[model samples]
Target: LSEIYPRNLMRKTAKMGGLPSPSEFVKLVNSSASQGDIQIDHVEVIAPIYEKWPPDSHTRIFLDSSNKTDEPVYAREVLSNFLSRAWRHHATDAEIDQKLALFAKIRPKCDDFQEAMVEVLATVLSSPKFLYLVPPGRAKRSGKSGDGNRLAAWELATRLSVFLWCSTPDDELLELSARGRLNDRDVLVSQVKRMLADPRSRRFSRHFVRQWLGMQLLDFLQVDRKAFRQFNPSLKEAMQEEPIAFFDEVLKHNHSVLDFIHADYTMTNERLARHYGLKDVYGNDFRRVELDSTHRRGGLLTQAGLLAMNSDGK
Candidate 1:
């Protein structure tokens, strides 16, 4: 039953009631359900399962299943793999050993192996190498000759991922980077197209539009409730999303840039459609809809959010 518990509800409970131990949390849930507080008809409670104990098949071969004899070997492998992803490059033997030493020092104080490993992993994540887009002195200090003048393949991949996905490079991008092919003209263009086709590229649209159009103002801008009784949070959220969705629509279709100034169609969802007094728009998801002159709306200039956020709420 605990496995089936919604993650968000657990987070909410933690926030409101304070964090509880696993047993205490299950007890709280059971007590709530039994008292008709949770409103559940059925619950089959089961003991907690430790999914990480056996380790998955990809990782299993690195560990000695019978005992802790191969723990150091396993730890080094884990750190190396983690560094490759987090640092966006291969970890040197020295780097791997440094983390392994940290794990060894922390293991004696922690209750279990997993806890100490988690601390080591956290240290890796918090590293300057992991935090910065391209860590200072890396290009100039790298072992590769002539690297000081230009970005490394791995650094280029990281920048491209940050530009398109707003996240770390996936396996494919990392592999291309590792092979030093990410900078090739044809390969770079192909990867760009591939990245744009990915769902993660939506982050590019959302973030680029927000920054370029100064939509961050809308985030903290307070709409006066008394002055605009019909302006609710849902409508405000729809307004905030409109321009990004509108930009994405034009970009995906390769429409003319002029559409931004005066498009015959606009992206909208139910809440925003209602605000614009349009009919037949359903659901929260934004989609392109043909516009008519009766709506008296078109382009980024006509977005409700841009107008409202720019106002003093009078």
Candidate 2:
């Protein structure tokens, strides 16, 4: 029964138009898992499981019941680090002391130091300082002059990272903000190029294209099997990814945005190529493919996914 599972899975996948046949799926899996194709370029451990913290570390000071003298220092260090990383800027002494007071109040009721600290950190995470992109020196809204006119270095870094990567700024970005170099136009352009080259920028492309083209329509799309026996779930999935990949390609090559309306090429995986009646392309990976007159396909206007999704499920 276990041996039949892989074959059965492949049959279902093939029927959904993911694979040409069960044999092809097996071949693709075998090729991928083959030892000859495997390579280990490098390995770097970012964090290691530690039974104990090193000397003078905040965790060590906090955990040692005998080190009551250093407990305030430990709290300050921990809270300050949390503020920098989570709130994306330095915390004032008052802010750190407030969190420390919370930790002290909760300490007696909690089972352990870790549990007390967890509650303190939860408040930090919940604070608007961490949750929202409120520019520095602009925390309070004011009708008076010069209150929220400009962004601080840290605020700009957070905005740039969130806009381009859909994530918080990395150490490099934060370091630049610390040194006050990120605001320089040349430095900013270089950082933008570096970020776009990084794979994280794919999130930007996917998110922007989805919102711009209203791709949410595809998510609720329901097709009638009897009306279009040739249409399969795999094809629909490929259709959804096509626009995102196409947008990424144009951004990658610095192509004019006009190409989206009428280009001689489109992005496709094997499933989508077959749906469009294009020949010879294979594999589940999408790539740029040149389209000809016979293909009668070009841009977002003629893409089957967009057409089917907007239909009445006929």
For candidate 1, the C-alpha RMSD (Å) to the true structure equals 7.1
Maximum-lDDT candidate = 1
Residue-level lDDT of model 2, residues 18-104, one tens digit each, is 434443322222222111343447544343335555534445324444544576676677777777777877676888889999889
How far out, in Å, is residue 256 in model 2? 1.4
- Report the CA-based lDDT of candidate 1 relative to the real structure: 0.76
**After superposing candidate 1, which stretches have Cα over 4 Å from the reference?**
1-69, 135-137, 140-151
Candidate 2 weakest lDDT stretch, 10 residues: 26-35
For residue 158, model 2's alpha carbon misses the true position, in angstroms, by: 1.2
Instruction: List ranges where model 2 is wrong by over 4 Å.
Output: 1-72, 108-115, 140-151
How high is the CA lDDT of each candidate model?
0.76, 0.75
Model 2: how far residue 211 lies from native, Å: 1.4
